[model samples]
Target: MGVRLNGRTAIVTGASRGLGRAIALALAAQGAAVAVAARTERVWNDKLPGTIGDTVADIEAAGGRAVAIRADLTDRDDLPRLVEQARAAFGPVTLLVNNAAFTAPGRPPRPGATRAAAGPPTTAAPRADWPPFVGTPVHAFRRHFEIAVFAAYELMQLVVPDMIDAGGGAIVNISSVASRIPGAGPYRDFSGGVLPGYGGSKAALEHLTESAAYELQRRNIAVNALSPSQAMLTPGLSYYRTDFDDVGSEEDFAEAVVRLALVDPQTVTGRTIGHRQVLDGSFDPFGP
Candidate 1:
């Protein structure tokens, strides 16, 4: 059955660009009033395109309802305000898509970082990449967990009350395939390069999903984690790796999210399934 979210309100973080933006648009297209949250308010160059305003504009232009919310998810104080702004703009928030992640080491790519050149402006900033565990610092792990794990947990705590009061809701935590630990043997360098911090934080997030799902199921709140079956050609990914092929599309990923968002808590809660798994009906939530 197609999803219909005429009266639902949604909060989608990292909606400035890439998969998050696509997810926000998809949800809004389905009739949900979306609060598009992200740190980027304007695009400085082609390297990082689109902004929260751009996302909202696209939704509105398509005859959907959405609001642009500039929020730094790294700030604990911003969490409450984000939820409050969404609640004030629409009614209670019944859909929460925690799609933001700390991919780089420092603050997100800043606007105006590009300088005018003879042909076109280019960002002088060096691309950020995951280093070997021995080379990574302690702060890297902390930052990853802070955004990908703690922030999502905090948001869940903030929204569960509303879901409980409104009778039901859904929380979809975007995760990564890196969360899977390799089986004991000669481990192939298949994941490109797995950063301990990013992978570990996602592992924690999946655990959090299961725990929250178990606790909130009785209250009719579905909490699940989703990961791309393969790497997708997001702007962020392009900025880091240039050789990715056969990657999943943002539209397909967004559709999988919508399905999870509309799932019945009693049946599909706590699944850490892949995008293809969700779409193909091969996700066995109860299986190992």
Candidate 2:
């Protein structure tokens, strides 16, 4: 089951790894020329695997068209250059995936540090001594919102003109279920690392998605927010020893995004979709 994306040009931010990388490869596999953008071009951090170069290499090796662009999403000024670089390599970007996120602040807890310890614990926990809202620094919240919300908005603005000129296009904002369900719920029921800053940013992104989709519909462009129904065992989550049994596949997100990208703007705009809905064939982006 493959979607046809021939003759389309796409720009996928955070394509160096995780969900972004998976989406980039899926788009390219369907014949879209992809611009894989991320901060890491090489394996500078041994702990973190994947890079823009690595993504491009895999795409090219698999006979898909792609190019690597090193761009930091945190720096607002660098966004236009990212789109420009992508356009230079693959023409105007009609498919934009805002997938990069600032993750420095909301990491899982450490190992065995007691409540009396000066610092925080080593593992994930919702304990009083853990780094929750009270323990989290203000700067961390600001940084996360800036990257996850501001950056995604700016990137969408950069690509709209091109998409309009091209007669139509799609923008997929990769959000998380946390945006809707915050605090200790089914997904957040884990031990530690339950910060609302990241989830708040994603919530903002989803709102932006709906707003953009409504305004852009007149121009034949479709903008939507999509999230995995469950947590994914990406490198980051895996670091905390997150069990994959209860999580969904990264490909679930990738496939749903590709499907959304191919849909007509009139039928599927101004909505936040989920991977489970997409898989079950009940994905109604226009539904209330």
Candidate 3:
């Protein structure tokens, strides 16, 4: 057994399915109680079942504690209730995964081939959310910002105080390759009110992670950004299936998040790390 997160609790936002479900399961496998939150409720019994319900059931079956929380992170008020449920069911959340995200219409469906791009963790070259600055619209930009930026920011504020009070904790924000690097290849605009904002907000979220990591470091809390190659094959990706091109999958992305949450809080802080590099152990999974 690893001392990594034994007896601790973790809250993963957007954990109903896809990468979020994978991370939640991974954390539970390692002995931490998990709080799973998402806007969509997981139907325990459905004709075509989803992973969210399965993840929760798996955790309980394995003798680990887990709770399902219905939270719309974009609505800031929901955060308090989410936190309270986690506390009531498990304990203080020693780990947090900022994994929920949003995208606009027509944003080139994510990059990669056969999920090759989402492999083993390393940095993915960032893509530029285009129409190049001139054609970008304010509403599209704002919509992306709401989920990609503010949602993460607000959730952290709602929970970090409790983490600090308990000594230290870990916060891993799921960032994007689009924000890490810059425009590559031909750029196409996402949809109305969701394009430019998605790119800008992700970039901004990385900045926010750094600032918070610095401020929270002394208290033993670890804060960092983790990005997959392109976007994972999320439910949101159903609309852009052709765009995936085998770059990433929810499982590969989920494992990366698990690797991050397992790190010692005090040791991993103030940096951005990619799944490709960290999963292999040539470098620390969570950069300091």
Candidate 4:
């Protein structure tokens, strides 16, 4: 029981694969009753090891408790349903991982700019055309924001009351290292689709964490943004094909989250922590 979460309940979004999948399994392994949610029917199959279904099986097999649900975390309708589902399957959800995100599709900020023709260029990966923010499409930006930041806000808004009703809860927002380095833009290869909404939304998500933490502190709810890792070696990062040598394995990130979930609520609210610090124990993952 070093950091076990026995009898506690956790809901992890984006649990179909990648980081979301890892978070769910790790929590289950720690004795928390977990609900793995994502839009994959495969979660029901029990064949794959890291799938939502497999996480549930792993939890039960280890004498822990868990369940898997197929839901698109980005869809607006899915939030309340997800919360209710957890309440029904386990009890009040005391832990939440706001992990799903979408990149808005638009022409990247870098492309065909003359020596003196551009203002600000895109700074990060998939370094397409580094156009100024003014040049980026409004709609594409909105789409990314909806999925990355807005959806997360919605989930938090819905879940907090329940956590209050249940006495307390912990909220972890799975953010990227990009947030820490404001200059990096989207991945160039993956930017072909678009992520205006994604980047813009995450920028907003930082504020949401602040607001959520400030207002809910009185209620004993903890809100924190965890910069899990760079895109060094994660499957989630491979989806973008962006390279950053500092990225850690999903297990590395998961371990930090588990430690945070078990800590006291007051110590961890509103921190923007990176895997470097969170995993290396520079900062107490559970402390505010």
> RMSD in angstroms, all models?
3.7, 6.5, 9.3, 9.8
Error of 3 at 19 (Å): 0.9
For model 1, what is the alpha-carbon lDDT of residue 134?
Answer: 88
Worst 10 residues of 1 by lDDT: 113-122
Candidate 4 wrong stretches, greater than 4 Å: 1-3, 43-51, 103-140, 180-196, 284-288
TM-score per model over all chains: 0.90, 0.85, 0.75, 0.75
Q: How many angstroms is residue 70 displaced in model 4 relative to the true structure, after the best TM-score fit?
A: 1.6
Highest TM-score against the true fold, candidate: 1
- Identify the candidate with maximal lDDT: 1
Candidate 4 lDDT over 165-206, as tens digits, reads: 988888888877455444557544543332344545666787
* Stretches of candidate 2 exceeding 4 Å from the true structure: 1-3, 104-131, 183-193
- Provide the overall lDDT of each model, using Cα atoms, as 2-decimal numbers: 0.85, 0.79, 0.69, 0.68
* Backbone steric clashes in candidate 1, count: 0
List, residue by residue over 1-288, the lDDT tens digit for candidate 3: 234568888898877766777778778777788998875453322221354456688778877768888777667778889888998888777788988776413221122323233222222222334345566677656767777678788878878887888888889998776673446535466442233455577788889998998898888888888877555656444433435555666666666777776566567766677777556666653434
Number of the candidate with higher lDDT, 1 or 2:
1
Error of 1 at 28 (Å): 0.4
